[model samples]
Target: METLETLSDKLDTTGDIQSIVRTMKALSAVSIRQYEQAADAVASYAKTIDMGLTAILHDRRAGGLSLPHTGSTDADVAGLIVIGSDRGLCGRYNETVARAAVDCINDRTAVLGVIGARAAARLEAQRHKADRLFLLPGSVAGMTPMVGRVIVEIESWMRERGVETVNVVHNRREGRSRAVPTSSAVLPIASEDLQQLADARWPGPGLPFFRMDRDRLLSWLVRERLFVLLYRALAEALASEHATRLAAMQSAERNIKERREDLTSDYRRKRQETITREMLDVISGFEAVSGSDD
Candidate 1:
């Protein structure tokens, strides 16, 4: 029902919107690459930390090495760190992580530590109060400071809440462009993993002697393990965040293309009708003049 001029104006507006979507899509692609690289780099560091922990655990079985705030057997409280995104363009990214965190509560007495404003809002909407709220780092370069802040906040929570265990709920990268919500426990390091580390065979020619006290060495290794675990979680979450954005943007781009094509078709049809009507008007006017001359 639109006139030719109206349709033409709408087409121009649609074109502008399409251009904006394309720009966002391009930005998402770049962000995905940057986060992917950061995740990969952190992965290597995590492996090195794992190897060191394996060696330390194997050598110190008799030293009574203990981790501070590891929680006594009677401790029943849990602390959860939920990682999500601050932005909303990515479809269901924050909701998926928030749901995972909620499921993890499972009637346990829990203290929630949330990262990202969008995530905190989702949990708060579900009637969960965050004991610690943190903003996600803007880039890979800022992860170190972010991790440091998380460490301090978590330690404080452990002491104040008498937390028995710590868990992280986040979106983990599955492949190049896919991610899935995942939950992992950090405190009371899984018995299976500890046993594996304890029983692991040393790759070198012989057992190496440590210059430091066994307890000190174990404490340092335990702290490093904890840091690496949290760091890896953050990295995975960041990478997954970007991947979701990229996928969402790609989908939006497709929708935009379809809409633009529809608008173009409509514009053409309207213009054609206008042209036909104008031609008919001209011919009728000429006929009237010819009749007057006759």
Candidate 2:
């Protein structure tokens, strides 16, 4: 029932909307590439760290170097770091992470740290209050700073609350253009992994010796391990965010194209009908004038 002028206006509006959606899709694609590259770069460092740890632990077995501390933390309390998207354009990204986080929180006394606005909102809606709310980086370049801040916060919680175990929950890149929610223990290094490394042989052959005090070197390596874990987790989460956004934008582009086609067809039909009606009016008026003259 829309007039020709109205249809024309709608067509123009839809065209503008489609342009904006396409631009967003293009930006999402670029972001995905950048994040993926960053993730790959960090992944290499992580691999190196793992190799160093394996060597150090193998040496420790021969030298009888034990951890300086008993590696015992308060058993009753724990901490969870929940990573979610700051923005909401990507469909269900925040919700999925939030749900996974809630499921991971089996203890009522566990402290929760939320990163990103959308995640905090979802937790709040569930009547769960976050002990701390951290902001996500606005760009890929800011990831290091954010990770550093998070590490400091986690340390503070450990000191102040005697939190024993720290776990991280986030979405990790799966297959091509897909992300899956994952939860992992990040602190107090799982005993099983440590035992496995302890029993395993070093890859190269000859036993390597460290120049520094064995305990000090081990402590430094442990810190490096923790840093790498946090850094890699943040990088993975960012990559997953970009992937989700890219998928969402691609879906939006498809819907927009379909909508534009429908609008274009409707406009053409309405314009043709308007022209035919005008022609019929002119013919009737000409016939009336001819009859009068006769």
Candidate 3:
């Protein structure tokens, strides 16, 4: 029942919305690429660190030194880091991560650290409180500082809060335009994983050799490993966030286009009806005037 003017105004508004959706889609695509590249670089560095640890562990075993007990058998308090999106419009990106984080707690006394305000709100709604809230980095360049801050917080939790095991929950990019929630232990690098790394075949012709004390070298490598893990996780989470947003924006664009088409069709049909009615009235008047003249 909308008039021509109303239809025109609706079309204009829809056009504006379509423009915004397209802009968001472009930004999401660009962000996904940036974060994916960063994640790839971090993954490469992590492999190198793993190789270093492997060589050091192999040498330590040859020297009859006992391997360091990395994982704690009895963790009195655990720390959980939940990585989520800062902004909405990403279609359950934050909610999925929050649910995974809550599942990870599973009735344990845990210190919770959350990234992104939207995620924190979700957690709060689920009756969980964050011990600390961290803001997500705005760009690739900002990630380093954010990672450093997270590392500092982790160290504090270990040193002052009696937290032993630290776990991270985040969304990882699945296939194109999909994100899956995943969780991994970040601290006390599992001994089994370390053993696997030590058993891995070296790619180079020469075996890795370090000139520093084995324990000291292992400590340095562990720190680097932690850094790489956190950095890579953050990158992956950001990429997944963008991918989800891109998908949502694509859906929005499709709906907007359909709505615009429907509006256009309605406007055209109504205008044609009005013109037909006006022509019919003019013909009738002409016939009446001709009859009167006759």
lDDT (tens digit, per residue) of candidate 3 on 233-275:
9999999999999999999999999999999999999999989
TM-score of 2: 0.90
lDDT of each: 0.80, 0.80, 0.89
Model 1 misplacement above 4 A? 62-74, 175-178, 207-213
Q: TM-score-based ranking, best first?
A: 3, 2, 1
Between which residue pairs do clashes occur in model 3? none
Evaluated against the true structure, the overall lDDT of model 3 is 0.89
User: Which regions in candidate 2 have their CA more than 4 angstroms from the true location?
Assistant: 67-74, 203-213
What TM-score, computed on C-alpha atoms, does each candidate reach? 0.88, 0.90, 0.90
- Expressed as tens digits, the lDDT of each residue in 66-173 for candidate 2 is 523425444677889988888767778888888988888876346899888889899889987788999999788898888878878888977898886888999887
RMSD of each: 2.7, 2.4, 2.4
Which structure among the candidates has the greatest lDDT?
3
Cα miss at 105, model 2 (Å)?
1.1
Candidate 2's clash total is 0
